[model samples]
Structure formats: C-alpha cells, structure tokens
Target: MKNSIFFTALLATTISLASCHNSNAKPVISNEIASIEKTSVDGNTKIQVALLLDTSNSMDGLIEQAKSRLWNIVNTLTTLKYNGKTPDIEISLYEYGNDGLSAEANYIRQVTPLTTDLDLISEKLFTLRTNGGSEYCGAVIQDATKQLSWGKDNDNMKLIYVCGNEAFNQGGINYKEAISDALKNDIYVNTIFCGNQQDGINSYWKDGADYGKGKYFNIDSNRAIHYIVTPYDVQITTCNERINNTYINYGSHGYEKKQKQAEQDRNAGSVSSANYAERTVSKSKAAYKNDSWDLVDKMKDDEKAIDKLKKEELPEELKNKSKEEIKVFVAKKSKEREAIQKEISELAKKRQDYIDTEAKKTKTQDDLGNAISTSIVSLAKVKGYSVEK
Candidate 1:
C-alpha cells in the first residue's frame, strides 16, 4: 500500500525541463486579484502550492528530480475537482540556502509568485542552481506564507512544501511562530526531509509538519527517477504537435511566449520520451491555459480580443489579415486545438493505466517528487476534493 502511494506521487511530479539565471528578489505578490479572478466561476476554488527548496551545495540531485517531475505533479493537480468543478491551480516557488542570494534577505528568494503561468514556472525553475549557503527553513516558510496571495476561500487547498536536508530550526525566525501564522491563514505546511527518516525527526522536520497540520516525508534526494514509456506516448506526442499548430500568437510578447512553449517542449523531450509524453498530457488538460499569448486561448476570455490587438503586436502571419480574417482563423484553430486535446486526453488515460500497472511490479523509490505529491493527493482527498480516477 505504501509503495503504491509513493508510486502515485512519483507519477504526479515526474516530468520537468529548461533553465535560466535567477531574477532579482521581488517580495511583492505579482497578481493577487488577477490570479483569483482567473478561477472559473462555476468552481470558484483554487489549489495553491508553494515550493520552498534548499539550493545548497549538496542539492543538485534534488533540483534535477524537481525539473524531471514538474509536469507529473501538474497532471496530478488537474485530476482534482471540488464540488465536481475543476479548480484553478497555481504554484509559487522559493529558493533558500543559496550563497548567491542576498544575505540581508536571510538567504531566501521568492523565485515566482503564485500564478497560472506554468511556462513561466518551468522557465524559472530551470534557473535555480545549487550553492553553498545557510538553510533557513523557518525564514523561507515565513516569507512564502506572508508574501504569496493565498485565497481565503475555505474550499481552497493552500499548501506550503518546504524541502531540505538541514535542521528545520536553524534559522533565526522561530519555525513554530511561522507555522502558527501559516495555520492562521488556513495554510498547511508540509515538510520533505531529504535524508534519513530518523535524522529528519531528530532535526525537527517532523515537528515542523506536526505544528502546521500537514504531512512529513523523508526521501533520498539523489535517487534516479525511473520512467515508463507507454504505447500511447507516441500518439500523445503527435497530438502535441498538432495542438501547437493551433495556437496563434498575439500581443507584445506573443511570439516570444510561443517560442517558449516550443522551447519547454524541447526541454521536456531532452529528459526522456516518457517526460515528453507527460508534458503533452498536461497540455491536454484545461489547466494548461495560455491566454496571455495564444489567440485561441485569449478569445475564450475576450471575444473582442482581436480588435484590441495592435497590428504591430500580431504575429507575422496575422499582420496582413483583417479583423474578420483573424477571427475566422482563430476560431478554426480553436476547434482544431479542442479536437487534438480531446484525443490526447483519451490517450493519456490509457498511458496512465499502463504506467500504474508497470509501477506495481517495481519496488518504489523515494525522491523529492514522490515526497511532495503524495501529500498533495492525500490532503486533496481530506479537503473534499475528488480525483477524477
């Protein structure tokens, strides 16, 4: 039973890619209202997860595992529904214990705010690098708790996952106080200790979770991730290509964002065939929205979006086209994307079944991905969220 649970969590987070240099620290919440407003009215709920990772000298393996398993975790989140309504999902990221960060900031940096831009998340996650530094678990947790725009809705699943190998109470900020504040804001803090279970317990990692009313997991941060290639993987990749052709870039950064989508695809593919397929499956889900760049996704929210776009902002292919022509083009592509997504969705189900079967035969291995996602699924169930089996 335990192995099955671990395998499921591994499946949830096991697809990630790409990297860039770290950005300057911005403590402010990027888009609080905008993020909440993006939530579908029917559901009016959100799944907000904040990842606090220790990027110290010894955590190269931990970062690699996170990069490899991003999409799997995203796919897992998409399966959850509250009151039978699909909830909007947002993830925030934080890096702590890096010498590259400002010491005045307690060696902690908020990499990204809670937002629906999964591509941005992927891009930023890749930028993280390990450096020898202090690991202030309490300080990082406190920043994530106070800074991110967490929803007050009782239905929202607001969770903070802090992963590291250091002592949980090493920081100046009292972990107990930080956890108390998080609970007051209705956020559950889960801890992932990247070492022996007893070591973690002795170091107060378990205590951190207990105080915040969340799960505590111990994992081997350096474990190699195993991927199972499914028969449907090829079909999913083909579907992904078809779907990419359906997006029409518009706005100032449209073309750049479009290129990023493809770049991320390449990054995922570079990891492994299974990771590539996992990303394709994530793209097929409703949560993989790209309204900020893709015309087809934009038109869903704003019918007059074409009229609002300046010609200079339009992609080269659409620059010469009239509003009516563009509208027709977008509409056509939207339908094509819908059809392709449906096909991928169907194939993804079969692919997952294949993986589940294969996973049952192998001994489960613990890693950062499994430790984090296992708790996500369990907590989702407790919070009245149902997985779409």
Candidate 2:
C-alpha cells in the first residue's frame, strides 16, 4: 500500500502542434453588467486545477518530475479552444506528509492558492522539501474542495489531482466524503497512485478514482524526467529574453517579480537547456499572464486600469510621463509583446512536431507528466474544448 500510494520509477526516454487561437485574441466583457458584478462576467472560459501532492520522505522524485514537466503541461493546455475562444487557466498547489509541516493541521500545507501566474507555480514547485510523515489523502482532498473558489459554470473544467503513497483509507476523514463534496462542487478528482498499477488497484486507488468520477493513474515516481531537445529551442529561448524586456514593472513587487521572472528562467535553465526553452514556449501562450505586476498584463485585464494608477506609482520609465504618454508607451509594449509571443507560438508548433516525431521512435516512461496530460485531454474533451493542431 505504501509503495502504491507513492511514485515508483525506472528511467527511460521522452503533444501535436497546436496554435493558440490568434495571439491577438482579447477577453470581451458583456455590455449589460449589473453594478454588483463585473469582474465575473468576462467572456473567457476557465480551467481550474488543484494539485495535491504527498511530500513525505520518499516522494522527492515526484516533486522533481513536477518541476521538470510543468511547461509541457502548459504547452498542451494552450491549445484548448471552444467556439474559437480560449479559456483562462488557474492552478493551486498543496503539499502533505512532510514532518516540517504543522502537526495539528495533519501535516498538510496549501503551498499556493489558485493563480494564473504559471511562473509562481514553477517557483513554488522548486521550493518544496520532503520530510518523513503521514500522508492524509482524504483530509487534504476535502480541504482543497472547501477552500478554493471553484467555478460554478457547468462548462468550465474543475479538477483535483491528489497523489500520495499510502493506503487510501489511512486518514481519519473518509475518502468517500471528500469525493461527495467534490461532486457537489462539480469538480473531478483524479488519483495518481505513485507505485505499481497492480498494487494501486489492490489498495483501492482505482476505486477512489471511480467514486470521484476522475481518471486513475498508477505512475512510477522514481523515473528520471527527460526533456526532448528540439531544433527550435535556441530561437524560442532567445525570443523569451526579448519578450522579458517588454514588461513595464509597476507597484511594489513589480520590479521584484520582473527579476523573479528572470530568476525562474535561470532556474529552468539549471534543470536542462531544453527544459528552460520549453518554459519559454509556455510563456508565449495566451494563458501566461501577469496582470498583478506587469503594466502590459494589467492593461490587458482592464483597459481602464491605467486610470486607477497614480502617476507616482508608475515605474521609473513611465513615472514622468503624462497619462496619454504612458498609455501610448504601454500600447507599444503590448503590441511588441504580442508579436514576440506570436513568434514563440509559431516556433512552439515546430518544437511540438519534433517531439512527436522523437516520441514515436522511443516510448517515454508513463510518469506524472503523461498521467496529468492524459487526464487533461480526456476532461477537456468532456468540456467541449477542441484542439487545433
């Protein structure tokens, strides 16, 4: 049961080409809006994901796999479209079973709330540390369902991917109860058993997935993650550096997050050049937005957001400029960003082709990356999202 609940692995090695709806697509808000509700009425659809991982002593490989393949997941998600409209994507993270966590809280921590900033997700994934402790699978699942602001739209995709290395019945809370609550929230709960498939089935991991109306995956967590280096990698990586310079930093953490963006680039590069480059492709997609810090993204979120900004709050580059000057400056940067992102999106298609060709010759190990992606494809179809390759 312990082995089945966590990842088991052996090493071996690494989507189709899909263009995000045009890079110029914009989120349109309804003209008829009540005074009380404006932010919630955007035309953009959404895919909300809650990731709960067991961080016990033996799960180090699982965490590493997450860090390595995070971009590929984003890369695939960028292809989603329904009626030619793209969806907003948000992800939340949770860790359980590390001895360093609060004991009274059942050794679980919500590492980050649901957020659209993919870089912050990558940053948080890199910061996880494993320690010995009990993994309360049921309790953690329930917490995410209750705590997160899940979408009420029946068409939106909502999911919980909770993985652990223990008996499904180990925790005090009932796994059935957790699944019931998830059902109430219209959220699908997928279970990834970290060990052998047979062992996972015997331990009722498959049954848990059944009750939750989600996919059942038994992944070998110990497997080494491999990123397939592509011909377009260099050009894609270079474009990301160019795109980074276009961001106009403002607010308190504006400059800080801008640097952090570069820092994560280095962090991804540390893993492998291919990994870093793949991250850039994901960043190029429409899903990667930083409205909280970058003026470019802020304006995209709300065209009127510039009026809310005080002149002193502007970045040094725009501080002395009048509102009209700042508007023109931001518009120019926004256009430049779109062009760079368009180039990256085009290159990403070529990169995906190279990966698909390579994958046919060599079967990549079915690990966390494949598991999550496979489930995503299945659920996405259910939500009426079509993939344009």
Clashes of each: 9, 8
**Which candidate achieves the best lDDT against the true structure?**
1
Model 1, residue 51: what's the lDDT?
A: 92
Give the per-residue lDDT of model 1 (tens digit) for 1-389: 00111101111121111111112333433353234234333346999999998888788788888888899899989999998988988888888887766677787777767878887778767767777788888888888887777888999999999999999998688899889989999999999999999999999999999999999999888888888888998989988888899988887768888998998998888878888998999998888998878889889989998888899999898899999999999999999888888899889999989988998999866777777778889999999999895
> Once model 1 is optimally superposed onto the true structure by TM-score, how far is the C-alpha of residue 235 displaced, in angstroms?
1.6
lDDT of 2 at 280: 92
Model 2 C-alpha lDDT versus the unseen true structure: 0.78
lDDT of 2 by residue, 208-251 (tens): 88999999998889888867888899999999889998999887
- For each candidate, give its TM-score against the true structure: 0.90, 0.88
What CA RMSD would you report for each candidate?
7.5, 9.9
Model 2, 44: alpha-carbon shift in Å?
3.2
Q: What is the lDDT of residue 39 in candidate 2?
A: 25
